[model samples]
Target chain A: MRLARVIGTVVATRKEESLIGFKLLVIEEMDPREERPTNNRLVAVDTLGAGEGDVVLWVQGGAARVISEEHRKAPLDVAIVGIIDAVDIADE
Target chain B: MRLARVIGTVVATRKEESLIGFKLLVIEEMDPREERPTNNRLVAVDTLGAGEGDVVLWVQGGAARVISEEHRKAPLDVAIVGIIDAVDIADE
Candidate 1:
């Protein structure tokens, strides 16, 4: 998983039949150090009720595509894995 | 899979038993457009014999950890999935 901030939303008129009702959120990649935004952006599926400007943990690839055994073949590439409540990076 | 250029290699003296003999590559993430280098960096296992400076495709999460049925429980989070031969971004 990686840190990202939900910036906006995506509306696709046509998509995979399996992904019809999934809400897509636009997310800007965040630097792991301080959660500062990066130049890169990605669209992620939201099933956790994450709203705009929410900080989230997103996963990519096979993990994102397979939300369940039945959805294993979904074409999704990114998913909002979790919403960040707090972060505690220990000093080394 | 995502595009990444292997920038360096990782040498871990002590690691998980499953990852002991694996070669680890340090990769800098790339932007989807023209494969421009991004600020993000990741350490990925190289089972495909990817070398430094090689442009490769990588996968994250379960796709990475489960190289095979035997290594399904490996703690790895990234893997070099393929070496990119070419990219063809069509004009829209």
Candidate 2:
């Protein structure tokens, strides 16, 4: 898992039926030392009760499907599993 | 694929052997309208030559595994496939 900030949300009115209840967020990749935002971003499903501006953890692929028992049958790539209150990196 | 901003880099002293030569970046999910920074973040592999502060697009799961031929054998869930020079959403 890597550190990132939620930049936006995605609303897919027409999508797989399984994704009806899940929320999708847009995320961007960042550098830790400088904390500068980069160009890499993705759409992830939110399982945790994370709102905009709340730092959270996201998982993908098989791991992502395992986040929620419901997702086991959903066709999802990214999923938010936890909200991060604080992060303590070992060092700069 | 989703939009994200790169926040930082990741250094894994020990990891899957197939991920040796790839560059990993930390990313945060974002919103397109308000563009506020949310809490959902993740680590993604960069295939494109994207740097800090550049918005990019990321793919995951089966799609991520297909980004690079090498990744077919690697254990990666997230990957940066392209740099987002611009994005035009339909409307607010």
What are the DockQ scores of the candidates, in order?
0.07, 0.09
Q: What level of docking quality does candidate 1 show?
A: incorrect
Candidate 2 residue-wise lDDT, B1-92, digit = tens: 77778766656534444567887777766676556556666677887877766677887776777765787665467788888877777863
Q: Give candidate 2's whole-model lDDT.
A: 0.67
Best by the lDDT measure: 1
lDDT of 1 by residue, A1-92 (tens): 56688999879898788787788999998765445888889998887788888777666766565455434566777877556664433232
Report how closely model 2 matches the true complex, as a DockQ value: 0.09
Best by DockQ: 2
- Give TM-score, chain B, model 1: 0.89
State each candidate's chain A TM-score: 0.89, 0.84
Q: Could you tell me which residue pairs clash in candidate 1?
A: none
For model 1, the local distance difference test gives 0.70
- All candidates' chain B TM-scores are 0.89, 0.89
